[model samples]
Target: MNNPNQFIPTPYTNSVDSGNFTWSAPSNIALVKYWGKREPQIPANPSISFTLNKCKTITTLSFERKRHGGFSFDLLFEGQPKESFKPKILKFFERIESYLPFLTDFHFTIDTRNTFPHSSGIASSASGMAALSMTLMSVERLLNPEMTDDFFYQKASFLARLGSGSACRSIKGNLVVWGEHEDIPQSSDLFGVEFPFEAHEVFQNYRDTILIVEEGQKSVSSTVGHDLMNGNPFSEARFAQARTNLTRLKQILIDGDLKSFVALVESEALSLHAVMLTSNPYYILMKPNTLAIIEKIRKFRSDTNVPICFTLDAGANVHVLYPDEYKGVIKTFIDGVLSLFCEGGKYIEDKIGNGSELLTVNS
Candidate 1:
């Protein structure tokens, strides 16, 4: 499972002319953010994330034998034809075609929908690519009925990473780690692994309330931002810092240290933005409301002695993270205070969830 070549499928034992698969994959919020990446979508640093429950993507992929060659596919977003999405999917197919050799064998119809907005900084790529990868793996399973559950999921994650690096983390549950870290022996740069150690009960069912600061495409796409890190002055130090934070955060999770958790998580979030700002052709993703929400979160935690903290992705939206026990108070605070900073008073309530699910399979 550690070798990339192992994911390449052998000749199929069974063949099907037509089939369809449906899967739902949840988005994840990285506690230790993965900013820059290497080629083929490998993260520059190790990172861990909380798999979110409510914000997800559900996709159905149907395939039929085609007479012509090349990767043929039609994409639909929420039941409407979406031509703009085809280019990304085409690129994904090119990246994964070697692993799944059936790419050109059939014409595919991919129908995808999301619970949240498409490019609103919610890691839609993570959930969307993860769901599509899961569905593709389902088709692989049918072609090779003897595939083990372990191998199936591993390859699914591996393929998802080719599409989006964070998408690999979306393949599994509550806590997942990606990238090679010395402390985590089983951790691989190939795909994300479920956190092996037992996290304290306090970390269980962690709540993440997303305050939507802006809802459209980001000013800087993650791809462009990641590319800027190529010659970034702070890149090496930032990667090293992430590794150290991950090691410390592992202990925090084990010991149920909410205080330390808040510190590390918030630091990682800010560091991610710092790297962006320091990159050549500097840019800022956090909007005014983003900073406003962060200030309010810190002040509220200071005033109420709550463990509440906030984290940001590569976008302006803020994900307010806290333990499940404080939901009632935090909800009140979010509703009364944080919601105002959000666009149209929009926010999504979510919590740590078990990863992706196979919604349906037909052959």
Candidate 2:
């Protein structure tokens, strides 16, 4: 048999039968949003994102040799068994099994918990799937032991993309780029690569305060929305625009041009929604409060010149991004002006992160 590790050019051997490993992976907020995709979870456009610190998922996988030799696993969310999550996990395993033949040799028990609520405008799938990918990579290393960090992360990102396209970006810290572009030599639609350029300190440590405009499930799932892009009148233009914006945003990040950053980020957010409106059999994901939050943010920016901006992720919630210097001022504004529009006046305080981490391993 060809060495699977070298074949994909990707893992180790472990004697212990029953063992556990855990990883904490942060969710990423795309500055240049990934609105559309191709088959097998490929991004239709190049996108970049800030990997957020406080919004993350911690997942632990317990593994034992399967007596009968078939793939099997159990999932728990927040310490409780969540049957609703099993089907998706099964489907994900089915999709990636070819790349990970060892999966059929073990039975896994996965426990996952998030700092933020599920289906509440956070990229739960991104963090969740990324964490799972890390655990699987850890196991692969334990079994094969020959891979380098580059191969490990590349394969992990590749596996994560198979689960959720955005999850691929969550594997790295600070800024990450996904999807191929002429300007970016190594970028690919199949997996994300870390943003190659050094970013200005101001943009590197930016804060993302999530304004919970609606703390409920989106009316249209991101999957459905992506599928609708098949015949979207603006699909071609949007893809081209994303490529162009990614190039511009990279320069802005390096130059520390907050003005252009704000304009581009906000426009990208709005343009994402605009595409939904102009799609065939149109639908709207932004709620009344979502608009209110945007208006309040714009007014706040104009009034105070705090260099703050907003972005959204196919939902009503607003992510108010700004420099750390504006934390006190922005918090005051959130309390006095923006809180009313949020669901139960809820919001999450987050910042650029240090990427995914392996928490523990028990053998």
Summing lDDT over every window of 10 consecutive residues in candidate 1, give the lowest-scoring window: 115-124
Clash counts for all predictions: 0, 7
Clashing pairs in 2: 11-145, 12-141, 12-142, 12-143, 12-144, 12-145, 13-143
**What is the per-residue lDDT of model 2 for residues 303-337, given as tens digits with 9 covering 90 to 100?**
88889889998988899999998899999999998
Best by TM-score: 1
Q: What is the TM-score of each candidate against the true structure?
A: 0.98, 0.96
lDDT of 1: 0.93
TM-score of 2: 0.96
Q: How close is candidate 1 to the true structure, as a TM-score?
A: 0.98
What is candidate 1's lDDT per residue for 1-363, written digit by digit as tens? 357998888899998899999999999999999988988888899999999998999999999988888999999999999999999999999999999998899999999999987755689999999999999998888889999999899899999999989999999898999999988769999999999999999998799999999998888888999999998999999999999999999999999999999999999999999999999899998999999999999999999999999999988999999999999999999999999999999999999999999888888
Regions of model 1 farther than 4 Å from truth: none
